[model samples]
Target: MTGRRIVSIWFPRFAMDRWRKAHADTDDGLPVALASEAAHGTVIDAVSEAARKAGAKAGQKVTDARAIYPDLVVEASDPGGDANALMRLCKWARRWSPWTALDGADGLLLDSQGTAHLFGGEAAMLADMNNRLRRLGFASRIAIAPTIGGAWALAHFGDRSGIIIDDDALDGALAPLPIESLRINADTALLLRRLGLKTIGDLIDIPALSLARRFRKTPDATTNPLRRLEQARGRIEEVAEPLVPQTVYRAAQRVAEPVLHVQILAPILADLADDLCKALEDGGRGLRRVRFEAFRVDGHIAALHAETAAPVRTPDHICRLFAERLETLDAGFGFDAFALTAIWHDAMPARQKGLAEDEAEGLALPHLIDRLSVRIGVGKVRRAVAYASHIPERSVVWRPALEEQPGVAAMQAPRRERPIRLFDRPEPITVIYGTPEGPPKRFRWRRKLHDVIKVEGPERIAPEWWRERSSVRLRDYYKIEDEDGRRFWIYRNGLIDDGRGGPPDWFLHGLFA
Candidate 1:
């Protein structure tokens, strides 16, 4: 328990607590029960302490409970609401430890190793946790131990609150506890109890070979009691998923009071931007994308994101990018914490700012692109970037302006003259040539016959060998001018006697102004 300190918290009356919180008008002495619809009909899901004392218990038929105590108060239970509430509590628990998670439906797990000293040692930390939850109207049973399973068992089944189990006392502490405390399923517990394995100590006394033979070793420990026991005794490592992501670059501030508006949040966001920018500059890195989040007092997080057209190191620029979008935050019950993370970055691009007006104007465009993207959407504002393909129609692609156009696009091989307007898909045309494989003398396109005044070429372009099979056809492109001086970009798919098919098909690919 001293090495990897784990904290397990159980909320025995979570559903009833939620119901009470919502219906504050209810008298505390009233016998309240939360009911749910089952195949057998309406059944009690959870009960208040007053109801339990009044002879009403969970899993009882609502009609029977009503007959037993006709004055009992019953409301439908919301399983989804209870689960969401638990997850919210898990995320909020990160205020004490970053490694926190929802443990089942009514518990929370926290990897509180090395954090106890911050809150004035282990006992004080537990005391603080109990006080905080009491203020939020939740009753909690907490325990800290060396392993996750041990902590969980002690918290749920231990004789006292705030139980801290040391490594040497782990066996003694767990031995007397019921086997169900190991988190095995009902069926497994029943099977073990039938075999005279009533307590954790009983399982420990069984031969290891017999235990393995009786229980199937499955990944889910709930079905395999032996595996659950191993995890509890620290024979297996327990991995708990963290509630918050540990981003590479981040800045956060916890406030004394909840902030209600972006006007109040702007300055805080600016400071975070400045700090993040300084760190990025030191590492010779730049912010390509950032996540700005507001943590609400009610446990909901309102998040916004900003992406740049290129690597940016300017704090003011980053702040400006998130300015307009910040107004959209749903600050329910207001936000008590704010965080910014440079989730995506790249090596800063080297640029020499010359005194020339054109160079300054060139830098302005990227800034403009970034702002436009945040205001509208990243996908709305787009630009063209070259693609690595010899096929004329596939040579370029449209992308979001916020994404940097790869340098390879600018350094690609020079291409031949292309038309100003390209067709989305080629249009089939009929060509009349003097020879079977010769240049077209005339062509009929859009139901109009155009006499070829000048035919430029049979520019041979082979299929992309790497992308297509060898059987794929090649193209013979041509620039032709009609008698009326209209220019068209056309190509013949395949070749005569190519052995793959019949005669080649001619099509119009583009148009020239």
Candidate 2:
């Protein structure tokens, strides 16, 4: 086809086919029918091949059908169950084309505009599509044409199903089809037939003014044949929304047979990662998160997800993330199809690579964090976030790296120089103060004595008088460098002769980088 190509698929016995597929152990030759209650009586909603051969059909009363065939197996119809399964099937159809959606309750619509070449050609694409559906235990009638309406018409009423119609031949191919192929309801079809308009050709020849007067002018008038005719002729465009929105970065694989082990999926997973990453690189974007879906033949999907600490387009990094999640993955009845998509992404502008493996500027921090997250868990890796407090321990809290810590407005960095490393609990140290309320001259810690070469501060920190008892003591913090140039953060616990304590004691709290 020229501009755009579409594929329409219809399931003639959708409910019955799905039911039989689920119960493969049952006798295939037995007659089966799905019946639902109606105002008049219980009616057959769908029938299997055996049931149809026994003179049973949809819309026929259950009693009447049973009258013709005494051994017909009757089961309650499940419209809701069929619909939910169909939606999943629509998503699974993405393995063939990203642009896929439910055509109706028992069909699918796909845009084949740019995807045909990937499957060889339009014919090979249809063959692959048919083979996959058949393997999944579905019976389908599919057709490809330049427009949605044309494809739908040909799939349902053409001389042969699974035919591709070129744009140049769409009119000739659609002319001989019955008016009901336009997808109008029975009443509308009956109305057209009564007016001697029995074929699409007849309706096409009718004057536009006459066709307009015969139907309502409102957009809700789905019974309008004129619109369907225009759509089929490619004069009017019909929009088909995909089950999953399109993404620039995606890759998928379909196997001829279902795979049973997680180990067997490694190469396929790697290939998908490489394909997706290549797409991201070409698009000038990076993947922040990706969704992995494995479609099983029984219609159940097994899904897993992974994300990065920073935007990335590396295949090995992406593969490693998924590898961590594969051990516990349950491959129910195995999987026949697999797909990958970068659901969340960010702009990854090109940059020059540096030769240094150790980055002092912290350029490699994100990669390190990502690796740690994968090894332990995505949620276990955390960083220190400062909070609004004066107490050394209360000044910051540990939180997950990916999670955004709440309001830093009330929090501020310490204006004073602080050690990069801090102790959870202060250790007691022996100190000789030059005088009362003065900085230390020497200190003994871990059984080693160190002479002070320089002293910076007696930064005063008052006790929380509101929350503490009258005995709570204030603190005098000092920044001192020993003679060897090794710095230490030590504090005097109380004032000398203060009512709160007999004498101030010194403790080493932290170390400088």
Candidate 3:
């Protein structure tokens, strides 16, 4: 396999640029600084280029910066907002490569291994990214290398904005860079500098054991210099988890005239759904969850989501689900664009239409479940499936009806009877006549008294022994019918003083309907 290629885009003034964009209308090329409260009062966290040229710098006291430049614009630094904006940009960067992740608060990493050829070459791709970001009011440094660590170091510290370090020249490209570029902590960097290790080349020839012994106080402490060196040289593998996109199949349409009425959305949604379904069909997939997005002319967005019991490729079915959720969407003034996306999907091969009427009728249940799930949120519609555990409570599991559930036939056969409705936590009841191992003749449950008309079982269940330090006590269950013909499944705690606890307690575990 060919070697992996990684690209790092560093936004040196991300926070300041975001602030500038938020106040673009009022900004008139004045020096700006984002300030945050520090131990010694407010200090500059980030500064614009104009502010940097005017004797203002990060870590400088706000009052000192103001004294240096009287007209400097000061804005409170919002680290969270800056991070969120960078994540949004990471989402937008998916247009260039699907594998893109946030490097830090002000940087992004893209795995463009096999994707660079799509946009001519790595150089062209970097140029395009630079141009687009520049247009978006962000000054970014783009660097491509054989490794993530190398790309990151070059992007932030290299003299060039667009540097492509080839595998053959990896050592030469990184040799002249400062030790700080190795991504060591400030304290470690300071220590390395004090030791006269000013460049990456200075540390490259040092013994790994010597370096570790000098820098690390304990044997357990990580050897940062050696690890960083290995990563930059592409010796150690780096794994990056990219941010998941909301949808795989998406279709959007921009309208010349804004749509104000909900009635007009049906046809638009149908058309978008059809397009999305067609794409799904071509990819041999079907949608399990879908979302409809409306971008308003007033710069607001309204969204509606729908889920299905099974993967569905039918456009009409998808449109119907959106139709049910249309009223929930507030279109604001008017919608200028509409987008339909299949957020969750799965591979679904085409199945033949049932030849027999009964076979075709069997499919209606899933469709009904889908409709109900869409109507009353997915969480509200649930189904019960047999669980593998022998314990009564652990023998059954409840999950969303729209989700795929394990078949009952696949589970171990129940050795004893189980109630139809099982309470999550068994309700404690007062027994009138019962032994620690016997059934109760009369019980008080939920402030209601019930006299036993017929008694059945004394099925004993023991705690699973394989589990480590199992605290579960032994249980003796009984199925009894009351005077009103109501049946219940009740159980007693541990055996009468089995050296576990005090007297055994009774609990109404479930009700049989």
Candidate 4:
């Protein structure tokens, strides 16, 4: 009772014999069924004992199997249906124990230690499981023992039926089983038989040290397979992959009843959120996004996701964000359970609270950005970030407004002024009466003539000498005023000595006022 006990079930020819029958109305005792894609097409993947007796085996070419038994019936394997079937079987097996896994395509392992008595005695439990499977039209062989190895052997190669190994009968039950039943390949089995180590009992009688030395060429030689086999008989530990993850570090509360009304669900959701928030805050981590999965009684799962502007483990704030998505959940057939999980968490950093309203207001900017982004689409709202480039087009970049602002130490807010209306591209405005040597005094711009009343000195900005200037022009910008009381910022392109072979031109760049 102190040692681990496990059960392994093998469907000798699950996919093949799941539905195939030897006769139309009766069971075919002599006819063995196999499931394969190759009847007259490809090779077989599974074969029954009757088919094996008729010289048919797995991986035998369809033609070869037909040569042995022409009347053999084969069907293509449906892997998807097979998987769904296995999952359904796993669910049914859960009635036996909470721990069970689909061991590959055709087998299952159940850990039934403390849970066995719930179904009666060990013999009765084993019989009950096997009978339930049989009633479900599955020809299954189930084995229960103190070790996985023993159970596997009993299920696959004992008396053409299954065996149940309790502690009292461990040695006696495993005495007659073959060493090959330990799951050695065909080649290894033949090699062991050649070495006069055929049955498990035969291999057990040999001294471990001698067997390792005598069979130096075999795979089992290194560890003395017999000793390992014996050690596994009653003292081995059973590791079961639970159908659901163990609820240890994680906590969950499933609603047994479907809650269609939001009023009823709101409090329950809020409670769970509060619990998670407390757990997260205590751990010094903030919640980034929380998922609420609603499992409906109709077997469909609907999920709602809420992402925060900042890492926050506040239950009230989290619940408010999720409220937006509650309308989308149909609650069809009613929601049977509600599950919540948090992702993208970060440790909440220690910081001083802002005493002034404006200081707190700046901190809330990121949250305002998140709300704006949700309303106008994430792409439309963002902070205007200034860059170090002198080129106006490359002077700024847009970023997601919801992202946390860079630490104040890393960002020095630009001291220079920014234009209220910046055009996508600077428009070219023609100006007359301007020469390359000086700024435009009186110019005709936009088909209107303006007389210069006040003028400023030209600020010459020359293009780099080695850089290509095919699309760019060297300019001397000047602030000017017209007699009508309008101010204009104008620039004259191409100095007299400029290398580019073009006449100097005047263009009005921007209006000063």
TM-score of each: 0.48, 0.48, 0.47, 0.43
TM-score for candidate 2, residues paired by index: 0.48
All candidates in order of lDDT, best leading:
1, 2, 3, 4
CA error at residue 119 for candidate 4, angstroms: 1.9
Per-residue alpha-carbon lDDT of model 1 for 12-66, expressed as tens digits? 9999989988988989999989999999999999999899988899989999998
In order, the Cα lDDT scores of the candidates are 0.84, 0.83, 0.82, 0.67
Predicted candidate 3 versus true structure: per-residue lDDT over 478-505, tens digit per residue = 8999999999999888877688788888
Across residues 1-513, which tens digit of lDDT does each residue of candidate 4 receive? 326567888887777555453234644545444445634667777766677788878777868878778977665656677778788888789888888877768888888889988978777888988888887777988888787777778888778555777777876777788877776567667878888888888866654434545545565522346434644464323344567754321235677778786566677678878888777766777766678777788999888776666777656666766665677788877887777678567667544456543222234665565556655666787776654334444456666665543211112434543344444455566555654477665778667888888878576655543333575677776777899988776667767656665777776656655
In angstroms, give how far residue 412 of model 2 lies from its true place. Answer: 77
Report how far residue 364 has shifted in candidate 3, in Å: 52
lDDT of 1 at 374: 80
For model 4, the stretches where C-alpha displacement exceeds 4 angstroms are 21-41, 47-55, 160-162, 211-231, 234-240, 245-513
Clashes of each: 1, 0, 0, 2
Candidate 2 per-residue lDDT, tens place, 426-487, comes to 89999754568787788899999999999888899887554458888989999999989999
Which prediction has the highest lDDT against the true structure? 1
